[model samples]
Target: MNLVALAARCRAEHDYNPLCDAIPYVRFLGISVSEEAGEFISQLAFRPRNIGNPALPALHGGVVGAFLETTAILELVWAQETLMIPKIINITIDYLRPAGPVTTYARGTITKRGRRIANVTVEAWQGDRSRPVAIAHCHFLLELTP
Candidate 1:
């Protein structure tokens, strides 16, 4: 379905990401949900505050990692279309280049889902979708004791 249709459906169902709802910062960052390969995709764009320091002047590695993880979790949550939260096991990120000062976007795709584990990959980029600034491989364990 198209974005408008997706939004309508989500509105009709009244489904939302609790994680996104919980973090006001995330909402402030302008993270949005969209359709991807007939599934929901979480998107993150760059802001001045998310910009890098004066010394190095590039996006922080930790920020990139967090974006990847959040995107991956959104992928899982989108696939499930439920309220229960999932526990992530491990996430590995590879930085390809320095993400420019412009707004960057993050997207996640799930490759495999098993009884207990799900494999996901996420990409973040700016300007050149041809070359991603970072790519992440994530392994998620659905249920875990707190």
Candidate 2:
């Protein structure tokens, strides 16, 4: 199925499994989404394969980055009812602390939105939401269906 149809199905069903399953990397990363208080929260289930530093036992920087980006994308889709996938213009990630070997949660907020573009900020936390492991600012080009 096309992304537009897949996203519609996800919204109608209030489940993101099919949407995540459509993306191989997202499925491999064990990313899932849930609604909390009318907001979307994304989770990344910890896995041994995601460890970048075996000694420090930290999640790979790339994995964390991907998780943040995915969260942003999902939020955009949910918030705007996007008809197509948002194309990334750019992303800047700040690693605040090492992501411990634990499930990570992320929330993306739309900082700004225009007819053709959107700015999103995402924060990922391992245990304490107050102490974020990483934060990301992302810009995406939205392609709305007419």
Candidate 3:
């Protein structure tokens, strides 16, 4: 489905699975979203293929980074009632700690949203919300329709 159609379905059904399903990378990473207390919480399910270091059994840095970015994009989509898909202009991710072979959760907050740009910050954690394994600051270009 196209992004516009997917966005319509998401809004109609009050679900974001269609949006996630439309992205192959999001599917490959096993990323899913749920609404908790009026906030969108994204989850990265544990998968053996995602392990980058067999010795440490840690998730790949790239996987974590991608998850965080995806979370930010989804948050933007969920928060806005627009059909446009936010395009990532740039993202900076900080790997605070190694992610173990387990599920990870992330939440993104929009620091600023303008007519054509948005800034989002995301935090990914495992087991504890207070301690984040990774954090990301992302800037996306919003497509404004006349």
Candidate 4:
């Protein structure tokens, strides 16, 4: 779905900005959706600043995990009729390369969906899409109501 249509749909169906509410800490980054592209229908962009880095100067692992989860769950939030807030069941991340101090983009896809569970895969990239800096596979627990 288009970005504006998606936003309206979120407000109509999910009651508020699912993107912002779900990923509040990353809201200042102004991360929004790009067009539907191939396997992934939406995208999120984040450039790790000095503050987001670890003591040793590497991108914080928690940020990577949050980015991946937000991107994946959002895709589902937009696609499904009844909004479901996904819980983290499990996540496996592979850091192919250290996230550099550049604009990093993330794309995610739902690999499998069950009654109350879903599997999602995500990749974060900078400059190169084919060679992602980090990749993640997550098992999600989705519940429709609070």
lDDT of 2 by residue, 1-146 (tens): 78789999888888877898898999999999999789899999999999999999999999999999999999998886467889999999999999989999999999999899999999999889999999999999999983
Candidate 2: residue 125 Cα off by (Å): 0.3
**Candidate 1 lDDT score relative to the true structure:** 0.70
Model 4, range 12-108, lDDT digits (tens) per residue? 6644355554455647544555443434333344454522565545666766666777777666665562255567789888888877655667877
TM-score of each candidate? 0.75, 0.97, 0.95, 0.71
Candidate 1: residue pairs that collide? none
Q: Write the per-residue lDDT of candidate 1 for residues 14-118, one digit (tens) a residue.
A: 454445655566676657666645656566666667766646577777777887887887777666622345578898999999876666777778888877788
Write one digit per residue (lDDT tens) for candidate 3, span 1-146: 68877877787787898789889999999999888788889999999999988999899999999999999999888987234888899999999999999999999999999888899999999999999999999999887551
State the lDDT at 116 in candidate 2. 92
Regions of model 4 farther than 4 Å from truth: 1-8, 11-18, 28-30, 37-58
Instruction: Flag the better candidate by lDDT, 1 or 3.
Output: 3
Clashes of each: 0, 0, 0, 0
Identify the candidate with maximal TM-score: 2
> What is candidate 1's TM-score against the reference?
0.75
User: Candidate 2: minimum summed lDDT over ten consecutive residues — where?
Assistant: 76-85
